[model samples]
Target: MAHCQFRLVNGPPQRYIADGVAWVLDPAVGGGGALRNLGIHGVDAALSLATGKLGLKSVSIANRIHPGPVEDHALLVLEDEAGALFIVEAGYTFASMRPGGDFEWRIVSANATLIDHGDHVICATLDDAAIVDLPVELPATRYRLFMRDTLDRLARKAPPPVSIEDYVAAMSLIDAAYQKAGP
Candidate 1:
């Protein structure tokens, strides 16, 4: 198996990586828990969502990204499955944010490039093309109950070949539903 490379970008305080595991940063929620690094395996398939919870609200595919960053990065709308929804930009030029999100980002993949921005994430590059932004939103904790619900829906209706075309189409459906729920 090929492992992805990762490099820490920037933050207020200096960050630390635990050799073969995750990135640990001081958390602000309570007793300063460390925000562990979740690598490629954590995002390989939808199942990774369960192990590495990157404060994801929901997952969706986008058809077009107009007047946004990156010619074609992931266009994700941040919505806490419980309620709160915000616009999130991923796979863009450099920055990505939910505007008012709480989760802190730490690149874990060996080759995952942390572009100097808040709303974007770029994985290993292929020749001159890179797998840019994987736009996703932060769902409320309530999504915990609906994990199987959403995951199953995606799996059952998943296209046969796991290519870009099929993946994007499915993501679009989920994205549409999220939009209907409002931002």
Candidate 2:
């Protein structure tokens, strides 16, 4: 059996993130605070790519930067049924050196290791390596894509890229992780 590892990280406390936190930093209302709000998406994507269908074996979490009502930094460690490891580090507290988003995703497989750094994706193998930039046409505005897909579906059009059921499953994982983290 072969295992693939995926990791995604983006952080360093930018104003846009802080501004957006105003709308989503509630622990009472949501299942989690910073980890759930900022980290769930990356977890979802990494899990999906790591396992076609998640056979989640176990989950654990470590929380940091808990200033007030909610945490500002969290580390999530998960195991798939196949025993592949998945770790997601999410935070809103940091001093950034770069001006742009600090986003990065890496996929490590037996044959190759691929990395996505917003503008480009790089693939490296024992034999060769290459980097291909993402087309400007395809931006990372997931909200807009979701809205458009929902509208299209409602209009009796194509099926949505992801269904609500998928979201529920992802949230379940986040919920389980938080549960294990405890109060």
Per-candidate TM equals 0.22, 0.72
Report the CA-based lDDT of candidate 2 relative to the real structure.
0.59
lDDT for 38 in candidate 1 is: 22
Output the worst ten-in-a-row residue range by lDDT, candidate 2: 1-10
Q: Which pairs clash in model 2? A: none
Model 1 residue 33 distance off true place after TM-score fit, in angstroms: 7.1
The TM-score that candidate 2 achieves is 0.72
Expressed as tens digits, the lDDT of each residue in 19-138 for candidate 2 is 675445556766566578767776777567664555444444444543555566766666666666666666655555343245555666666776666566667775555544444322
Count of residue pairs whose backbone atoms collide, per candidate: 30, 0
lDDT by residue (tens digit), candidate 1, 1-183: 122122221222222232321223322222111111221111323222223222345534332432221122233333223333332333322233333233334333334443322344445554555766665443343246367566776789864334565445434433353455333
Per-candidate local distance difference test: 0.32, 0.59
Q: Which parts of model 1 are misplaced by more than 4 Å?
A: 1-101, 108-110, 114-121, 124-131, 141-183
